[model samples]
Target chain A: MKRDLALLLGILLALLAALLLWALHATLALEPGPRLAELASARLEQTGVSNPVTAVLLNYRAYDTLLELAVLLAALLGIWSLGPAPAGYQRSGPALAALVDWIVPLAILAGGYMLWVGGHAPGGAFQAGALLGAAGVILRLSGEPSAGLPGEPAQRWLVVLGAGVFALVGGGLLASGFGFLTYPPGQAKWLILLIESAATVAIGVTLTAAYVGGRPGSGTAHNGTGQSRTVQR
Target chain B: MADLLILPVLVPLLGGLLATALPVRSALVGTLAALATSLSGLSITLLVWLHGDLGTVLGGWGVPLGIGLSADGLSAALLAMASLVALAISIYAGSYFAGSAQARHFWPLWLLLWSALNGVFLAADLFNLYVMLELLGLSAAALGALTGKREAIAANLRYLLVGLLGSLTYLLGVALLYTAYGTLDIGLLGERLGPTPIAATALALMVSGLALKTALFPLHFWLPPAHANAPAPVSAALSALVVKASFYLILRLWTELFAPITDIGAATLLGLLGAGAVLWGSWRALRAQRLKLLAAYSTVAQIGYLFLFFPLLASLPPGTARDDLFAACVLMALTHGFAKAGFFLAAGLVQQKAGHDRISELGGVAQRMPATTFSIALAGSALVGLPPSGSFIGKWVLMRGAFETGQWWWLPVTVLGTLLAAAYVFRVLSRAFGLEPTPLQFVTNARTEIPALLLAFASVALLGLAAGPVWAVLGFGAAPA
Candidate 1:
């Protein structure tokens, strides 16, 4: 009876929300120009990217993207702090292991291509990074030790590399009196490409590390004091 | 000049990243970074207070086209409060987590959370605010679960989900506003907003979302467990600063964007809910068995007091009385920020010493730590609105405004909540006065005990006696009387 009551109430709330949304839709007046896109286009030359989205992500509103990377790193840090990685899955059979060996290198190549393409085309750091993360997932599924990633210390450095690089570039610009992330017109392209490349590698590592679901080995293997308590209810 | 405005957000981001990347496990680097971040933030606050509001358009793009950071009186007040409270918590945490494995995890996340708090206070663009809010929420949730206990993880999982829900709801509101207004800057949206169904619905979505994040009344269920179960410094930050960020946003949106569309009826409804929160939260706090849980519930009651000012502010005409009400609201919120951080830090010490926080078993344990006990006493007195504390002045102005507006009903609720606050505070204090050996020194473990004592002292002495500067800093011309 309680479940039925809750269901009924939930449906009623949904209907009410739909009604309100319909009323809102009827009254909203969308402006003629796509304002952000137009702004991006007007400043595209100075931003040094042929693609408007890349210009926006890397140049125009780079602060948001910087903080977004911090969010991803924070999630990975949270996972690692919980405990060391669970022991690797039972080693994959011969067929699966053989397949993984071929797939991993191709994924890395594809990630690099995507990273390079993001400067003038439809791809960007996040897309490239997702590809690399997929490779790590593939390796993990094949029961590879360390998930084809670095040790814990190297993993920590790699995870923080994207945000670290972004901040350095921004601060360097600020120090040079052009303000944060404000690349000069001629240098904008190279600077953005550099940041994006760094970002691609860092995001790829972070996402894969997050997927591994715990701290990397070798760092915590010897320090018993560092081990997080097993969660006991 | 723009560098000054941006540095508060930038320093912490850099510091956090460096702290995470560096192999140095000592807490010195993180503590110094936190110190620099707080000092930079304080300089910004001082500049804004002295020179009036300052705004900077990033990347040399003007408003409506690029993101900007702004510091008005509201931002300045909250920024100052966050800086002071965060610095104290940082110091407390440095000592509390010393030699623990979690120290490495604690510092970076804490700095990131500070960066997000400053970002939320200073962000001028709506979407930028959303990004900052997400960073704040994610870091806060992660920090909350750092204890790695089952209940901590469970509670903070719920917190994370609730935070995500709030952000999505707020983003939908921003979308609707952008759909109508052609811009996402708060100033431009304010100029374009009108009394329409879309605007009203957007208001509801955004406020409801913030209400959830702020833990207002009926939506406050997730706060207690999430707050009380975290490590002490994390709990201090969660209650004292994280929730206040959302409340600050709600206040900003209400005054800046929704002012033209708002009605008295809506204000009264919010005030009514505030009354409910005060009564319900305080009652629960009184009945709470654990020290941290009581502190958590007290936070709920304190938030209710903040909401109570809205209806009174809405009803009165634009003049000194209303301005006094507004200033009082800000003052009270700041006082609670300092007092609550002190309370939680001290409670953590008590819990650490006793191995548990069961209120019934805290008799000899609390009395042993004289310095921490004194810190709790001062914080509790401030919480209960005793004379010479900031809340006393704030409640005086608030109640006067209620009477002047002929909304006399809120007064009784305020009085009851105050009484309940006193009861719970005394319940803990009563334990301290029980038969036990007296300590030889008042300042024990100066590193941890001093932060709590200093914060509690500031809430009562600095805020109470020197509140005139707060009025002046907020750019109000003179006292309302």
Candidate 2:
């Protein structure tokens, strides 16, 4: 009886505390301050980029993209080193292949739209590329002969090339007495767009590679072929 | 300039995505990931120190509409510590699981962890911080599940569930703040926040949510089982990094926002619970059969020491008292980070050699694995706050600070925690001395023992090194307590 009474008291105290906090919040009349919706449009004008979000992702926050590249490349290399195992010997079913036939094109279209519209919309390189990568995985899982990642050499070159181009372009700007990754005053738009395009390819390929663990043509691929698991971006 | 803050987080994330794509040589991918992350950490630490606070004008839109990443001194320090431990763990793990099947994905998960940790530290905006924290929780759970045992899977699932609940509560707090205040940037919130009822409620919600995430006893149901069952490197990272990050935020919020009200009565409540955790955890650790469980329980006890600072510091009025108070907290953080990481690594070596971490059967194990044994002992010494270790100095400062401020109760709590630590350390060490009547034989490879020894030695020498620049670095620039 004592224990039960104590428990009830504890519960009541908790309820009282909750009610008190709620009352405090109600009396204070809190609200979200400001939403910088106009700044996105304004930034597009300043950077001369059609999509402010894209400009931000590829230009303003390019370092994040850079580190992301490092992660993908690292995963790819790890999978590459461990390839040619018996685990990569599974065959995909015909039904899955048929599904990929339709889904792949749609995925590509959506990915492209996301990249293009990211300047003003909610989607960007990361989301679009991830969706495209999902399509690639679907094709591979569905038994498409070339559904998987490309050869190691080609994949490595592609991954490096994206970072290479960004770095090289940025390096030139550095040489011009600005700084690393500084887009020239008037050319920020095109430079930003160009970087996003490369990132799209790199991001798409990277996500796909992480899932597939290398391309189909690249000697028995190793990585991603574990006891099948679903992946998310 | 602000954008650079986000790069450290993004690079590993992108790399994690690409690591899945890499064919063959998956370990190499993980190695590269570690390299990239370490580089990012080092550069960011240097940059932040050289310049000042770093933040991102995310999405070409500043805070409110778009997210942002920021690194102040606190974030930089935590980032540096996380990077160092991750680098060490990666090196040790490289050879530890060299030919294992999961090595391919190990690097990917690790990179994911790296990104999550960095993101959590750099996140300037509230929503982003919540997202990063969730990512960290999920990835940590996934990493724990990698061992592929029924126990590991179950523990990880439980951890995930509890972690999600914590995150949900924290998210709700964020919503409340958004509903109450206008901004999410911690700095902006600090400036805009008045001592209003709504603001106070928001603070309460946020603190409680973070406290739950940090697992301050009563709420720490998910920590021990999950931490004990995980693989060595994973356990080390989780204990030394993941939980600490949440606490880091709590500390930040306290120093930044709640300093005024904390002196009233709320801080005392937290300290009281902390005192309980110290006793409960130490008592459990002394009685645990498994080395891993012992270590996990020790973490509970160690965490108690961190909370003691709040009440102790708040009791002090302004001036040098505050400076010493904050310094003690920082020292405590640094020492715990190193010592716990070393302890976990040592425990890993023991488990690998014996095939089980059962303490009773570990007799005469020290004969073969002296390095690992030494490492464990040194780490244990630090954990116990024994003389000549970083932990000793940290505890001494804290004790003195407490006494100077008239918080005499902390003395008993600290002393009791120390005694319990000593008892447990001796329990492990005495068993290692071949005194057990039913002693079981053991042998361990040198490869595993070296990293453990290095980390342990580092913990021991940490205090000595601090006399130089590291000591100066302690209070280089800060608002004191």
Candidate 3:
């Protein structure tokens, strides 16, 4: 019965894919009228960022990005609520530790570079944050507990930093009679950089905490049963 | 005035962040934030009431390039209902999870979910709605699993996965629409959309996705366990607000955005599924062993009733009759929002007192906690479409619509669902009247009991006795003419 069900589902999925492709083809075949691309490029300079993607993310559609950060924080909080982190792996060998010693610093430096170049280039907060998070993961694999993250209290503040700063800036703007998230004239670049910097730190911390897979603590307060369920990755 | 539109979403968001950072003071911050958020939402509703409609593009960027927030009559009516229900839930939660580790986690996630709910009601961009939906889904699922029990965890995990799939499907439809029309703004898309095959396909995909999330029959398998196994406060939010958010989306899409392409045949198909849900869900609720489970199944039936209006709406010509039908649909939704939240809150108190919510075992709870029992009775009456309940008016309109539209086949479904609803509600009430030592006062633990009682009273008295406001808020002229 299970096999039959699976086969039926597979067939249905195939049909759906075919239908979706056809629909996409029909949709794209229409006159690709004036889209946001033209409008975004036309008003690019006013956004204070050369990169249109950054302009959209940080300036025009910043509300969505702010909520996306909240989504990230919510996910990490969900993980933490399950319980504290399990025991870390065994200590790494001298060679592995040495490799981490070199790679971690280089990753951090690259992350900073990415954050800086994000104004006019491909790298940005999310990418830079991912690099920093990778470094944390490497540190964890080398047997560092907590993924080298701070204590619980500081970790809490770090996870919310991105969304908090973004909201604060927006609210400040609104209070000053500018629309929410509306950067002041001649100040959009600096504001975007500030928001992006905070976001990078927040994203990095959130990703690392996620990799740790649970709350960062000694596990004394939480229920004892959670330990058995915690997978040691 | 339009600039104030963002506060409903902003206040709760900042509150969530604050609550996360200051875990020790989360409850206080969360409660204050809930108050502020409700005020902002209610004020927005009031503004829309006084001033027709309000719209604002964020960051001063114009539409088709920037996201817009708009509050129309439809959104404002729902927003008013959501604000009141959410504030009551927040109060109930302050007591429900008091002095537990869960309280710290619950407040932050709960506030985040509130922000998303507000975002959904006001968002003018389809993609922004998608983002809001994701945030709502994630926080709701997480909040549902706060109990840490195996069943709760398993059920919520399934819910999370299902919600993600639904959002992805919806996003695909959004992408399709954006690709075709080159805009994500709902207003712009509505103006540009035609009766094209791609438009139909996009509608199908989007409605299907939303239906899955809304737990529209046949696709409602994941809702029962997920809702029933959740902590009570979470269960109330899930049943009352979360499901309604998705249904609200479907209603907007069906009646406004997709109206140009939507045919009566498709609307009838939805009504048929709704009929199935009404019967199936009510039958299941009638047989449910536990109170929360019964409430969950009843939510399924209630949602079914909401969809039953689609066909009637499609068949009606554009005029006061159609407008009245639309207002009735919104009234039914608002009534359910209050009734279900009240039912779940009261049930939560009963469960806490008794250590279990098995319907057969709840005998003396009514006598001991008269206020809570009364809440349940009142909320259950609204569910059963009793006299003077908002749903009573809702059903009256529904049956009348059925007759006028010649969709008389739906009459039997409505009557049978109402009968089953009464049977289930009375089954619990019967348990409540059993011999036991009665308390002297009506309310015990005013913090918890009052919110439930007020919500139940709102559904029965406030909404039913004075439904003119609902019509007025919907801009259908006072008293439905």
Candidate 4:
């Protein structure tokens, strides 16, 4: 009976939503116009990037992107707070190690290429960062724990690099009489590249660290239970 | 001055980044950063209040393209309230988590949550609000689950998932809105909006999603568990500021973006659900076994009172009477923010002394902490809508508005909720007056006790007697026909 009632309620809600959607379809101007696309393209030259999407993400709506990085950082902080990173993956067999050795550097090179091409093409910080993170994943799979990542102290700084640099550059712009995230007219391209480089590195570290799933020392403990530190009572 | 609007968001974010990087010095850095951030936020609010609304398209990109941040009377007032409460929470947290291993984790997340709260209040772009909402949810859930207890982690996992679903639904609505209007700016959409099926669907998706976040009745199932299971400071912030951010968005949407499309029938439906929340939440709160659980349920009830204003807002024509009701709604929400934070802080201390918050066994602990007990009493009176409290003023205006609109049925519900609130508050306070030897001094630790007392005192003394400024700050003049 309880399940039936819930089902009934769900159905009723769905029907209500459908009806509302139907009403909106009938009365609203539901057009698929290229509103932002057109606007971005028009303002693309001034925004200091060739790709309209890049212009939008890095310039026109950079504030959202800035906060997005913060969101990523916040998630990592939450995970770290829970416990230390688990111990490194078990040592891979020699065959897998050979494969990882070949794959990882190629991934890094590809990530660098993606970062460089992001200014005028379909590559940017996030894409490049994802490539770098993939390399870390390969290292982890091959049982090279730490996933090619640094220790806890260094990892902390690496994780913050994206948001820290973004904020610093934003503040720098504001100090120079430009609005926050507003690159000066002629300097937009270089600044964008500089910010993207930092973001790519930060994102790569954060993704890999998250995959590592605990503080650096967590995996070192032979027992399943990680060390728990208690603050002063 | 338009540029100052970004400071509230930037300062805490920078602080969070700094704390995240410098793990060894996070506590000291986090505290100083929180203090600086709150002071700067308060100053920005004052600047806007004195100078009128300030808005700027970020990166100098015009509307329809760039995201914008605006600080009007509404945003400014809430920003000021949030900052003050956050400052108190930061100070309380400093001592609460002192020397704990988790302290490093707490500061960065707390600062991030602070930044998100400011971001939500100040965001003028729809998609921007989505990003801010997601940030707020992640940080809040993480903070809420800091205790590492089985129940705390489980409850927060559910919270995190629920928050994700709500944001995704809200994002769908934003997508629909952008498709229809070609812009995500609130003002631009408001100017272009018309009553249509797509608009209706957008409104439903957005409002329902926000209602879930706000923990409105029927959708509020996730709230109490999450609120009650969190650490005390986290509980305070969750109840006082985080949940209210969602409701603020709902109010902003209903009055501004959806005004043209909002129907009286829809408003009445919301009012009915609110009534259900008030009655049901109060009853649950009254019967709750744990102190924090009771506080959490009371949060549910208080949120209902805020929603009761919607029907009145829809019924009344645009004029002073409507404006008065609007201001009163904001006043009630602000009062609850202060009152609830004070109650939770005091409750935390009491629990610390007793080692548990089982209300029936709190007698010995209650008698010892006279200052903490006093804080609860004051905050409780405000919660119960006793006279000389801001909630008293808020409830008065609410009831009067109901009468004027001839919606007299709401009065009985309001009265019953108030009485139930009073009963539960006194039930807890009754423990304090027992025959155990009481402390001769009113205060025990000024560091901890002062923040709670000051918040409770402001809810009653400052807000109740000096509410004229709220009206002026909202830019509403004396009532006009």
Candidate 5:
């Protein structure tokens, strides 16, 4: 009875929240996005940045993008620094290899298409990255660590690409003639496309680096006991 | 200016990232990360003081597009106190985790907690602030339960539930406001919100939810055990910073979101709860025999000083001689923040040194460690509102204003709380000085005393700093002085 009551209450609360959200949308007279956002978003059309959402995520909301990239970097560093369960590495396969082979190429193709289609519609670099990351995770589960920690220079370059590139663009915009991240009046779409492409590459690699940092025997071993966080998972 | 504003978050986050990435132990990296974060926070706060309001736009974002972070006089003062307290606690935590195998879990959560703290301070948007608050609540709960004992787990579970409930309530209110006004940006919301029923209800829900999290007297049932049962460094962090952050939000949101809903009855109700918290917390603290429990209860008392700002809101309205109430509350929060962290650190040291923290058995313990005693006494002095401590200056201004404004009732409550604080603070100190027949030989580090001393000295110096800058940054409808 108690369990059922809790379930019922939770559902009620969720429904109420949904109703509230609907009412809010109705009352706030919520419009499509905003004119400025729409105007800025149009930059994707000219730039040819494969993924529009990725372009928006990486360029339009680049500040948050930079931070999110940092979070990914932090996660990777967390695995490396904390050291992990010794020999926690395992590669699993069954009929899985055959299935994975069939899915992997299709995923990549879909991801690439999504990346290309993002300019005109909802797809973009982030969706491509997610699909790519999913492939990486599957690969890791199949024995490979999914990515390699390159030389210090490569690592440093990759890590700073998001913030560094954003800064360079904004600084250049201000330094040249436009304000900040502003294009040459008519070339907003092309400039935005450039920024988005770089952002996608930077975000993808950084996230991969962070994700791979969690594997066993990579550096997490004998890392002091201070880095653990038990989320009751 | 942007560098200063962003460093507080950047250093910790970078340190946290590095700590995770470093080939060394994650726990050690976390401590180093915390140390780096505190040092950065300290320098940033100092920079804010020197440069004037430190403002930064993330990826150069601003207004409605990108996020903006500003550290004015008020944030600088509070942040200075917070960072110093966090730094000392971090050092104490160093000794704490060295022997424990569980250190790895400590750094990530600690770093995350630090990140959340920085996030709250630097957040410029309402939704961003909500996200940071949620992060803070989650990290604090995880930290609380790190000990994994049944009681600790239970305490942490309760804390997590309460925290999530509070956040949900706050979110619910925010959603209502968004429905009513169509924006989640604080600056935008303020301009949009006027004398509307929706706005009034939103403020009520937000404040009540915040008050629950702040552990204001009626809603303070969850704090004592949660703080008391956690590991010492964790305890210090939770009691000194976690609860206060929620209050800081309340104060910030009060000025930003609820400025228009200036209700007299509501103000009195909040003040009444605050006054009750003072008497109730101090009373319970006096009864607690366990040193840490006693210190934990004292936190409840300190929290009351924050709410005194509500009632005095009118007296300190614009075009006035800065209602001394505002100064009083900020002073009280800052003083409590430092002195309480010091007290917890010292209490932890005592527990470590004596094998237990029995107040009665602490006799003659002070003779062997004068530095620790000096720390406790100094921290206690601040708690008692004695001269040469920040709380003294805060209470002095508050008392002066209370009488001058002819609201004499608050004066008694302030003095009463001061007396009660003195009683409890001195009680522990006096016990430490006892000439008992037996002296326990528990192991303690000489370095342990430093964190407590740092906190004590900070509280002492804060008393001497000029207040003009402090109020200027509060900027609660007032322009920078």
Candidate 6:
């Protein structure tokens, strides 16, 4: 009965989607102009960055980006709450370990480059952070426990660095009567860079910690018992 | 003053980050943050009460380009309710998670969730609302799963997935709106919106997505387990505040942004779903074996009552009648926010004292904890719309609206739902009155007990008796004659 109900609901959902698509097709035929894009480009000079995307992301709607960082932090904190990380794999053979050693440093260098080029080009903190995160994952697969993350105390600070710095900057701006996240004239570029740099480190650390899949270190021994209780249930 | 609107969202966010960094001092940081957030929120409400409305574009960019934050009568009223209820929950949590391993995890995530709730209330940009919703969903699900129970984990995992889907669907609708209108600001879109098919489709999509998150009837399957299994304070926030945030958005969209596109048919469909929810949820609460589960189911029923206003609101002409009905709707939501939080907190205490919350076995513990029992009873009265409770006023107005519009069918549903609510509330209260030795003291565990008692009192006395201020906050001047 449940399976049949699911199938019926699926069909109904498909019909709804089709109807929505038809409506959208008729609406788009009216040809809404690229007004927002033009506006962003027109105002790009006022923003610190040359990239229109960054202009909107960091200056125009910076509040959204700040909250997005908080969302990332929330996700990482959620992962940490589950329990301690599972044991790492046995030490990798020398050849794979050597490969990981070479790849990790190179990935870090590339990540730095990506972060630098984001001001004028396509790469930004997120892409750079992903590379850094990949480097940490490689280290973990090579049998480094903690996934190349520092101890729990340092890990906490690193994870919050992005959102913490972003919020502090915004708050400081607000206090200075510039409004929240509103950069001062001629300082928008440097401010965006500083915020992006902090976000990159935080995102990279958060992603690596999330890859570890649980809380780090010896402080969370209580959750071990809680995990066993779940098993018993 | 307009710039102060961002403080409510910012203060808690900074606190969450600080709490995340300083695990040992997390509780202290969380408490301070909660206090600051509530004060900032209430101040915004005060400012709105003094001034008509306030709006600001972040980064000094004009609307349609930059994100904006705004506070009007509707947002201010909900903001004030959320502030008080959250402050109470934070106090209750300070005791509930005291010295536990979950304290560090709970503080940061709870603060983050509070920040998102504020963000949702103040946001004037559609995409910004989506971001706030995602943050709210993520933190809420994480907090709900804090118990580490198998059922809690499973239920919250489902909740997280469902939330993501809802946000994505809502985002799709937003993308369509941007495509059609070239703006994401609520005020700008409202000005530009016409009765176009795209606008209609976007409204449908957005409302449907928000309905899932709000747990409107058929989409509420995940809510009961997720809410029932969470640690009590988390459950209180989930049931009381988080669901209402999404419903607030739907109300804003329907009456403010999508008014030209909205019609009686869609509103009636929503009302019918609400009727289904009222019956199904209240019936389930009556059948629930556990105290927490009963409270969770009651939330589903309470949300149904809020939606019942939509059909009436759609049909009512712009006059004092419509204005009064809207105030009553906001009153019902605020009362439920306080009442449900109180109910869940008291239920948690009962569960703690008894080591289980099984309703059938609660009589002894319920008798032992007099303060807790009283809290439950007060909250239950509000839930059942008893005399001199805020929901009584809400129901009176709801029924009046129904009669005024000649939609008399809703009156029967309203009546039946109320009867069911009374039955379930009395059933629980009856457990408290069982023949066990009465506690010598009326108050115990002042830290926790007082918060629950105060919340319930607010629902019954503050809201029920002095609801005139609710209209004043909503800019409706005085209470309806």
Candidate 2's TM-score reads 0.79
User: Tens digit of lDDT per residue, candidate 2, span B350-392?
Assistant: 7877788888888866646777888889988988988777677
Q: Per-residue lDDT of A1-233 in model 1, one digit per residue for the tens? A: 99999999999999968967785666553434235667668877888889888887888788888889988987887887787776566678899888888999999999999999998988999999999999998887777646789886788888888888888898898889988777776998888888888899898999888887887766447357465423211
- Write the residue-wise lDDT of candidate 3 on B1-481 in tens digits: 8999999999999999999999999999999999999999999999999998999999887898899999999999999999999999999999998998889999999999999999999999999999999999999999999998999999999999999999999999998898899999999998999998788889999999999999999999999999999998899999999999999999999999999999999999999999999999999999999999999999999999999999999999998888888999999999999999999999999999989999998988666888899999999999999979999989899999999999999999999999999999999999987766665654389999999999999999999999998998888866543
Predictions in order: chain A TM-score:
0.89, 0.68, 0.93, 0.86, 0.61, 0.91
Candidate 5 chain A weakest lDDT stretch, 10 residues:
A80-89
For model 3, how does the per-residue alpha-carbon lDDT over A102-140 read when each residue is reduced to its tens digit? 999999999999999989999889999999999999998
Who is ahead in lDDT, 3 or 6? 3
What's the distance in Å from true for residue B53, model 1?
0.5
Report the alpha-carbon TM-score of model 1 versus the true structure: 0.97
Q: How do all the candidates rank in terms of lDDT, highest first?
A: 3, 6, 4, 1, 2, 5
Tell me the deviation in Å of residue B221 in model 2. Answer: 1.4
Predicted complex 5: CAPRI docking category:
incorrect
Tens-place lDDT digits, model 5, residues B50-104: 6666665543334554456667656676677677788888877877777675565
* Candidate ranking (TM-score, best to worst): 3, 6, 1, 4, 2, 5
Alpha-carbon error at B159 in model 5, in Å? 3.4
Instruction: Give per-residue CA lDDT, model 1, range B306-390, as digits (tens).
Output: 9999999899888778778889999999999999999999999999888999888888788778889999999999999997889
The CA-based lDDT of model 3 is what? 0.93
DockQ preference between candidates 1 and 3, better one: 3
Q: Score the docking of each candidate (DockQ).
A: 0.56, 0.15, 0.83, 0.62, 0.14, 0.77
Which has the better DockQ: candidate 3, or candidate 4? 3
Per-model TM-score versus the true fold? 0.97, 0.79, 0.98, 0.96, 0.77, 0.97
Model 3 chain A: worst 10 consecutive residues (lDDT sum): A224-233
Docking class of 3: high
Computed on alpha carbons, the lDDT of every model, listed in order, comes to 0.87, 0.70, 0.93, 0.88, 0.68, 0.92
Fnat of candidate 1, please?
0.53
Provide the lDDT at A158 for model 4. Answer: 89
Second chain TM-score, each model: 0.98, 0.93, 0.99, 0.98, 0.92, 0.99
